[model samples]
Target: MMPNTTTLLISAGLLLARPISTLAQTTDPNVDNADTPFIQNIRPDRPGQTVTTNMLHPGQVQLETGILRFDPTDASWGTRRTLSSALLRVGFFNHIELRASQGYLHPLPGTSVFNEANPTVGPAGFTPLTVGAKFLASTNQDARSQVVLLTEMTLRTGDASFLNKAYEPAIRLLVSQQLGARYGLEANVGFRQRGFQAADTKLGQYLGTLALNGPLGGNFGFFTEAYTTWQRSTRFLPGLTSGLYWRPLPGLRLDVTAGQQFGNLGTGFTLGGGLSVRLPK
Candidate 1:
């Protein structure tokens, strides 16, 4: 029997590395501090459209839950509310993790042009379940840079009122860079299929986001972001968002966020709050 390359690499890593805690450490400036306790330093992906590149260590699990509300300046769009938005993450390897997300979309009231545009919406329904995996593509300790690749699929497993019969796929490239010792920068680029009805033509849009985060003294931190999306046939949609997060515990984070969309047809704003917790392995 011959030893494989993977086996050799694993053996080399085991031999070169010193024994350390099973919990993972994070590069996030807000969560990584001397005063912070050691509870698998949690890096949450919530309160914003931009997802972080931090990966949980093997055997770790994290849960993020939140609620969001959106109100468009135009009445025809009606109001949108997400009663429950949740994401579950489980680390299976040093550089790989599994993720799943679900949310409930409350129906829009009254007759509106929005109903015609989205025939599958306007009733209380479960959002399509999204399952994905994130892989740490590369990292540089000296440069303080990290790159992550995320691939996901929105399965046709929700209520028909939502997007229950569509197979939508998405991929994102996430990048993080540490700025000095107190701030970090994150950027994401991706594309995904978007449409409500399964039978309707779905259009894919390219999205990009840039965010900056830093500590606000003590257990508090702040983040601000700008994001935009574009389709070949449609105009670009741009938005800005900012949020504050409180980490009372090393394994928990609470955040409140607000953002507004800029569009010629109509403008909308969103407000949301969420909490993230890293559980015991």
Candidate 2:
């Protein structure tokens, strides 16, 4: 006599339900706790580590190099030039950093003749050097907010006979906040002094910039910024700048930027690229 199909089906169903019965038996609080990791170790909202430096720790360093080009709208009034620079930054304390940059300037041929030159008929050759410091004033971990202050001075290092031999200084304030898990916003305001001949000496220029950063994918991110500058002279020329940044490694960064002069005093286009490498903490 062959076995009944109904009986065989019932036996198979019971076999299939054995795992469910086992799971039900293992659902006791004591057994579950014994098998699972501790709540503290598995907490989902635990805060992450912060990036910091200590006196005992080796100071962090960063090196950057870039090339910049200035294109004048009226070639007769202003000249075209290329500048190359290397910047070095070192952390002195957790909240402070020092930066130094030195560069060479090369004026393009036929771009130096000033249309309205009297005694100074053409553009001058000059090497530029700058030194600066940044200080972190405040930071909040819960809010993901920070404030920083920066100041710098730039000096001309070329022949005084050929270039404007003076120093320019600037100060800036920066505020940054994390907008979301992978997005950040930054705002900056600054003042810059231009140094030149007695007739061309100008007061400080006011500047502002807004920046945004977001993650593009795993370990990849994107950044963009827009900036505006206002000169206080009677000429009334404002400038606008925009740029993008890319990071391909933990301590490496690349930036590309373009800017144009606005208003009457001077009009020009600027193109530049920068690379930075950060040292291990």
Q: What is the C-alpha lDDT of each candidate?
A: 0.76, 0.57
> What would the per-residue lDDT of candidate 1 be over residues 120-221, giving only the tens digit for each residue?
435456777999999888743123577899999988777665423677788999998767665779999998874545433346878899999888888898
Best by TM-score: 1
Task: Give RMSD to native, each candidate.
Answer: 10.5, 14.5
TM-score of predicted structure 2: 0.63
lDDT of 1 at 91: 84
Q: Give TM-scores for every candidate, taking all chains together and pairing residue i with residue i.
A: 0.75, 0.63
Off-target runs (Cα >4 Å) in candidate 1 are: 1-40, 72-77, 108-121, 139-143, 194-202, 265-267
The residue-level lDDT of candidate 2 at 81 comes to 67
